[model samples]
Target chain A: MADHAAHALEPNPTARAFCLTSAFWFAVATTAGLWAAGYLIAPDFMANIAYLQFGRLRPIHVNLVLFGFVTPGLLAAAFYYVPRLTRTELFSQRLGVLTAWLWNLTVTVGIVSLSLGFSQGREYAELVWPVDMLVVLVFALVGVNLIMTVHRRREPVLYVSIWYVFAAVVLTALTYALGNVIWRPDTGALLGIPDAILLWFYGHNIFGLLLTPLSLGVAYYVIPIVTRNPLYSHTLSLLGFWSLLVVYTHIGTHHLLQVPVPTWLKVVAIVDSIAMVIPVMAFLINIWYTARGKLGEIHADIAGKFIFTGTIWYFFVSIQGSVMALPQVQRITHFNNWTVGHAHIGVLGFAGMIALGGMYFILPKLSGKPLYSRFLADLQYWLVLIGITGFLVILTTVGLIQGNAWFNGETVYRVLPEIHLYYVLRLSAGLAILSGAYIGLYNMVRTLFFNPGVQA
Target chain B: MIQRMTPTAVILGAVAILSAVVFVVIIWPNTTVDMTPSEIFRERTAEEAAGRKLYIANGCVYCHSQSIRAFDWGHGATRIAQAGDYVQDEPILLGSARTGVDLSQEGGEHPDDWHMAHFINPRWTRPNSIMPPFEHLGMENLRLLTRYIQSLGMQAADKRMQRQAFWKQASTKAYEAGIEANVRWLSETVPQGWRDIPTPYAASDYSLARGRMIYQGFCIGCHGPVGDGMGDAQPHIYPPPLNFTILKGRGISGGLIYYQVMNGITGTAMPYFKKELESQKIWDVGNFIAAYFIDELDANGPPRGIDAAYEP
Candidate 1:
């Protein structure tokens, strides 16, 4: 097990800090999401609060979930797994700890700035220049810490998990700088149609390049360990990793297919979008097969349960994503809540479940103790599951109603009353998610700091 | 043979692929998209630019898209969005959602007063709107915002603004020229073919109930519950919503009301409902206004068309 006395005593302060960061922000992000949902059904609930407007609140919810909650949660697991898998301590725990604090500071600054109306006004790229710089800086720092750790490894051949972590950190550092247009500090954007082309390219990659790779890294490491099985195939892992990088990078223009972007760009986006099934199925087949006939083991562990469920959602979201990029399908789904539903399935249901799973998987190991409470974790799992399911069903229904009505020539205003009932239903779903986030925060906080569980 | 991967190889390979993708996807397009201004494009004034900042600041782009597609049937649907039209927009607010309608052609759709009422509280002008109130932006900011909004379609918006300006002057002059002159002007504007055409449907109890529902949803915000033009938005609207009772002795015809409702009084807060409501709904609401507000009825009057099988 490579359980040297020196390794046994190492505290992994960075992973602990990130665990707290992820749990704390998950609560805040969901609360913001619930507030945004409230504004949809009752626009007057917090009327005229400039910062609390639906526009501002929606972006805040999105950015926090992407950066503050899911990314850190996934990274928490990465920080722990990288060192252990390499048969060495982290290159510098002090720098890793500093990165965690700086990450928190950056997210805090983002919230305050967005509330004060200092946005750069681009979706997913709304953090103005300075905040954008901070985001880039953190990605670079994470890349350095991980890469240097790999350099000092006692192990010779890199595991698939290590490959994914390296790609996620290094590639994201490059994409973050390019997508945010860091060179154009004043506007942090390009001019006109090109700007839109660039914004969405960057936006889609925040999920594709950053969250997806990091989440997969954790899955690759956690699944085999928990299920006590070797990976089903090395070839499948190689194919999946390479295909994901090749296909996912250029599909951003699918967002602008209905807009005035070049027809050729749309074609590239559509074809590659459909081709995404290659990487998606490859990864799924590898993971699902490795855990084959091991349902009881997965059920016995909360982390395994969450990650295995996440794979199912990954299958759904990827297939849905491919189909949605088709022009005929997008004719009905584009620019509506259908896209919102799709985003939730990908981010919250797939990546978010994995992030939480990864954090839970590593928490006890990092602390040298058993989990604080399995019951609380299970309760949170159901709440989030129920909430996301409600979101998927209700939001997809609303989008269909809106799309058909608009196609039939009904004004956007006329369709509002028709969807009011659905919005109310969606709000109820959001409440479940909000409750789940708080419950997760409480469980994680107790396990990290105050748990009385016996040391394993 | 087992392919071995080192940390440097993984990181370098991924970055190299990303750089190649960037060149093809982003950089190639950067040099190619025709940036020449479109027929309707124009530069924004400083005030309008400031208002665009406010729009971005408030995240209006989240709900209201600036890009209009070819198949769109709502406002700004007259012209499809063009690449050149966005030449001057930095960060390009081609918003992703349509919780509200597109604003690509919103300029001069209504006069300044309508926006005043709308910005203060959207529900004041649009009874069923889910759009959040921007009253927090205050009066002056709203004015600057109105300028930006009124410039949405650029040259196309300028043309609409000219039409609105001409009508505003004429409508105001007629309104001040006393009651008789105003009613004459209102009816005279309708073509001879439409002025005397009686509403095809009879004013049945069933029809009136439907009419009442439509009025509450579409008109009660601006026309008030009692049809006195004293609705919540009245203070913000100039020349005010018409007092329906004044039309009682003026021989107000169903055709005049229907035509006005279908096409709308462009210079006023009344938007054309043809895109939103069908012919039956427009007739139903018009009949309801005549019976309940003006104390008159023109449905099934002289020269009435043959009764439909569904009529009671």
Candidate 2:
């Protein structure tokens, strides 16, 4: 029973499969995003084409990113690391592999269904009922497999990363079920505002419980390892974890602040949203402390560079979110490109960066070889960083102009011509991300199947 | 504490957190949400429901907002949105953006003919709108979309449609009764002050030129380049567009022209320009119509006041 035994030595077939799945869908999701950006610049760019309409393509891009690119990318690492952390073989590689196949099919079916005009029309719960069922089934499968591995663990102390992995899977399963309202199975909604409440409850947590925790988990595992420093404090880690659960869950109603939702609920949401600083600062302080003065070492590992940048984005996104939740700030930011800018930073900038980092981190280990092309991976990192930052700046400018004009007596048409150039700039920015996605896909595919590098 | 937990306890804790949020956020809202429909709300007709689905499937909600807030300004301030208005809706389409105009009160704002042309291309009605064309939906789907748009204000929409129907019959009958009778009816429908009041500004070359441009932008689709009432919209409009030649020598006053253009004749293809045009532009276009089509000279004569300046 040596400490080095905590590290996995065998190839993880399920993880490799998920890595491939994530690479393929990253290409697809970004392509959909590019079309959405193009449609904004010229509403008639792909006009009259039913499946390619901005409305349809937008949901496609969003759902695919959540389930396709980011989720699988994170899961690719989780499937590899969870077993190693537990000091047990995966509960069942066959089941995990089956789940991967099913996950890919679910995403494909979701795209085909949305393209064919089948949608429940809720923002995050856009999947049709049958598709929704499939999503639940897959989440359940993955959760059960991971939990069983935990059940058989040889490791006595559950690392914080393992706690995070469990939280993401089990929490997301419940959130997806409740948010999508699978009980009704017909309309998949409660009546009126309650449905909105339920939807955003699920919606915000999809990022909070799922992406945020998973990305953080990957960072907690990879950052200290890359820096060759132990975690700063287990006490601080637990504080951050519990506080995140307490604060993040109740802030969904910040979206409904301007609407006529209950004042108390809005107050609670706003208070908790702003109060998110506790967990955010706790997590950042822990990670930054662990990696203090180790910039050179963190940058040396391509994966560590990505995860470290993700922590920085987490700081920016968290602060922006807390501030934006204020009623006054929301008046200007809500329902505008400012929020869009925020989402791009949160998803593509923070969660997406970590997911990509985790994938790159695990790819070499799973494939039993060095990364085939570090240059390509580093190129993608820069491309995504520049692309997402560009989105934030351009979209924020456009949003302020539009929001201010709307506050005045100006008509929507008056602001359209003003924001046209920003839309074009956003499209150009999207090209960088789109190119990055394809490049990473090529790198991952080669690393997984065709690497010419030396064995690990 | 999180590190000390076994996997089972950790999952239980996650469930506890999730259940807590669900209780406060979802269950609380559920028990408290008012289920009553708003005064203006009613159940959707089958066609309207179908149209709503079309609206959703096509992603029209992405650009158009169904809810107007207290500080929305412009048309968004026309009605403060009530939660009750959406009780009967399966999925509320209270959209997030106004990439186009707010459609919360969009019902009956324009005639079906206008929506049809605008759907084919928004530039047909508004020269600067950024709305994507829905021509790909084909006419059947477009009509369904029109029904949903017209039903946005629910019962309020029905009342507007009633007024439109009432005036439509009268307008069509007047048009069919011959030009002399048509001009008489058009003049009489205007308020007495408007029918008798001449344009306050003298018509000039600049005024006429501005009027022509305004007409081309707004009225050309239905009124035609020559004002013969055989515009491209003729086939879609019932009773056809008014033949301006009919107003000639029939005592068609500038006041009558201005009034008709300002408020529009409901039920006909003509739409109100009150929101879209200013007072000066309406008078200018009226003068242009009088000088060119009717050979009238009310503006050049008296019953006028100080002339409005060019910039003013």
Candidate 3:
């Protein structure tokens, strides 16, 4: 425990900048989430308003949450941890700061363009071609920095986190280009059934490759240190890492189970989606074991607490994701609020929470001062936790109602009344998350700039 | 000093326990849902069987679910799917998404010609369907695909197909009787009360905006950028697309338009948007058509003094 505490006290300006930038985007993403939630509840609330309509705002919210909030927060941690794990200073602090600025600029462009209805109309890959290219470029730059750091490492043993961070960045760069079909500037799609298959393969991978691995990497790093214990088994962590790469890479086809792709492809997807249990459980075991009987320690550190809770959500989401992949279950879950709920859970509840934890854990270490407001940080945590949980319950119930009604041969109008309240509840929860984002932004800014003459 | 499970061991054990619980609680039952597709689909003629193969091959089942449950009636559901419906179906084709509407009871919904046009390019018939064109399938295979899609609901589909066959015979006769008779026949399908009522809402800018919004969200997907009813989803709809201009100077009533939009023209890809859009949106869209394409305004008389916010 003392050694872990000692390790956390070192100051690094690169880490400070990363944390500050992450906080800014987190605030933006949650605000978009709240706006979209409000639109869902009262379609008329901002109807006819150009920037706030559900058609435009939903994509903005989704993209912002993915790129603006969660991605940046995770990368901020990676920027700090990757170098430390390798026992090497970052290859270029100036380049790292430049990447953060460019990344924020790209996300800002995406949010504005999407709000103005300039989307390409694909879920998750909604960014226009220019922004998509920018994202790829950003990934390439991050890759160069991280890989170079690895090359210059003082330590010989490359940890599992290093593997995941590199895989996520490189795979995302390749898949984003392919899935966006960036070459076809006109429709951004293939001609027929091939298009649908290609699109969802990219769509599902956004969750599988980008968010999933990044969140797991952060979890692996945070849990052991907080518990003041050695990793139970490096072997298990490595096994889990490789299995995730194999299983998650191919399971994107699960999204096409209902489409007219090859039956053989569907078979592979279903099998692998089920087999996701192997990697998912392996990682969970490794992390939870690292924190065994250390609940007290985790609770005392706000970052550990958030990261631990995120693991619990990963359990719910991956399990639910596996079931939803089944054709039978998908019969009721697809094209309704059910999948939407899963999207929020996986994106906001799982990845979003972990990113915040990473930011919190690194903040004081980089700044050489305690957090500006522990009370406010804790408040933000509770608010987001409640908000996301509420969203899950409300959206799931609405999805089930819509699914069952559609299956029963009832008219769509007859089911609207039943699900109306759930939408309203989701909107209320979004408000909580939105406020939390603002609170986090304020606390982070204060910690970065306001020089209080006290050190804990 | 306290001794507890090492971090690594604890994480591994937690993983094992959770995995076992997931396998037991979720996966086991999913695998056991009596999903032997072959067992359910045993009794079919060679043609229906052929049609089934096409359904599977084209991925028609991907966008359409053959199963109708008790709670589905709110979406203008016709019949609840039964286990008996699947008695002769092998590898039951209960699809996962509703990109296109459900087809459990699609057997006799439309005439063969409508299906032909729809299979060729759904937008020709339904202006808002996202269903892709099957023109590459050529005329014969298109007909075969139509047969399969029409037969999705089994016995119920058979009943509906019978009605379509009956109507086709009469409608063809009426058409052969020339323009006057055909127009009369179309108008006669409407009840007397609907024939007389003009639109309740007057033509206004707000109405046009509301109409435009609904058009973009629902109609524009199928109907083209203009009101020619040539939307992108048209390629998969049948009976060819409705040329809204065809309704021009035809004395189409607001009530008639409302009814068709609300209930959808049965056996066509023009889905009832009653669930997705509210009553006001339908009325506004109808008015947009009347004013812009048809150059007719039935709401020319004194304005109804109803509350301004009334949706229907």
Q: How many backbone clashes does candidate 2 have?
A: 0
- Show model 2 residue runs off by greater than 4 Å: A1-10, B1-3, B73-76, B175-188, B192-235, B239-262, B273-312
As for TM-score, the candidate ahead, 1 or 3, is: 1
lDDT string for model 3 (A1-456, tens) is 113553245656666666777778777767766775665454444444556644466567677778877888888888878887889899888888888888888988988877665666556776778998899998898888888888888876666676678777777787788778789764454433345455666777787778888888888777787888777777788678767866776676677665444566678789889999999999989898888899999999988988999999999999999999898898788767788788888887899899999888888777667888989999999999999898899888988987877776544434555676787888888888888999999998887679483765
What RMSD does model 1 have? 1.7
lDDT of 1 by residue, A77-149 (tens): 9998899888888988999999999999999999889988888888888998899889989988988898899
Each model's iRMS: 1.5, 1.9, 12.6
All models: lDDT? 0.89, 0.84, 0.71
Give the clashing residue pairs of candidate 1, or none: none
Best candidate (score: lDDT): 1
Task: For candidate 2, write residues B1-312 as lDDT tens digits.
Answer: 644677777778878987887888778878887878789988899999999999888777677877788777653366788889888777777776667778888887777777787888776556556667778789999999999998888888888877877888898899899877777888888899887888777778888998887777677767777888777666667777777866666777778888999899888768787765778899889878777766776885667676556534
Q: Encode model 3's per-residue lDDT on B168-213: one tens digit a residue.
A: 5665666568656755766677687777777888778899888886
Best by DockQ: 1
Per-prediction TM-score: 0.98, 0.91, 0.65
Collision count for each candidate, in order: 0, 0, 64
Instruction: Kindly report which residue stretches of model 1 are placed more than 4 angstroms away from their true locations once superposed.
Output: A1-10, B1-3, B73-76
Single out the weakest 10-residue window by summed lDDT for candidate 2 chain B.
B303-312
Evaluated at residue A143, the lDDT of candidate 2 is 92
C-alpha lDDT of residue B27 in model 3: 41
